[model samples]
Target: MRVMAFDYGTKRIGVAVTDPLQIIATGLDTVHPNQIIDFLKRYMQTEQIERFVVGEPKQMDNTPSQSAIHVKGFVNLLKKTFPDVPIEMLDERFTSKMASATIAQSGMGKKARQSKALVDNISAVILLQGWMSKP
Candidate 1:
């Protein structure tokens, strides 16, 4: 079984999938919020996803972030649609900044690093890795 992770945003959502063994998490792609369900439905035809790890935006003081409301709505829809697949919310504070730092250190050119899609993908990977590391 594979696990999927998502870094939800207003304009785009980053997606990542783990290997069948659940060892390594790899960034899959970025998709628009409106097309997310269709995208996942297509992806599900080829992949057996058992769980979803969604990034939960939160403030430093442990309060919900501005985007949290939208994320919660998304989560609710996901639960309703994929009733058999368990959904988990993982704190995603500072993930975007971390992804940017990682991209800067990776030797990618400024133009490539500036791509929001790439950043979103990396952020999803970061979120998945953090969730997988939890005991």
Candidate 2:
């Protein structure tokens, strides 16, 4: 079974998946919030996903941010949609900044670096990477 991660947004949700051995994570795609279930259903036809790592926005003081309410609703919907699959909530602060730094280091051109889709995808990858690194 493979592990998956999602960088959720109001408009789009960036997705990333780790190989069965849980070694490397690759950015998969960005999907609309409403289409996520269908997308996952199609993906599961070939791959068995064991768990989902979802980014939870939080304030600097460790309090849930306003966006956390939206995330909670999304989490509830995700749970209802995939009852057998467990979900993990991760504090996502500065993931976007980290992703941007990573992209800059990759030597991508300015246009590519400014692409929101690419940033979201990389952010999802960073989220999964953070998840796997936890002890």
> Can you give the TM-score per candidate against the true fold?
0.98, 0.97
lDDT, candidate 2, at 4: 96
Candidate maximizing lDDT = 1
Model 1 clash pairs are none
* Off by more than 4 A, model 1: none
Query: Tens digits of per-residue lDDT for model 1 on 16-120?
Result: 999999999999999999999999999999999999999999999999999999999999989988899999999999889999999999999999799999999
Residue-wise C-alpha lDDT for candidate 2, range 1-65, written one tens digit per residue: 89999999998888999999999999999998999999999999999999999999999999998
**In every candidate, how many clashes are there?**
0, 0
Q: What is the lDDT of candidate 2?
A: 0.94
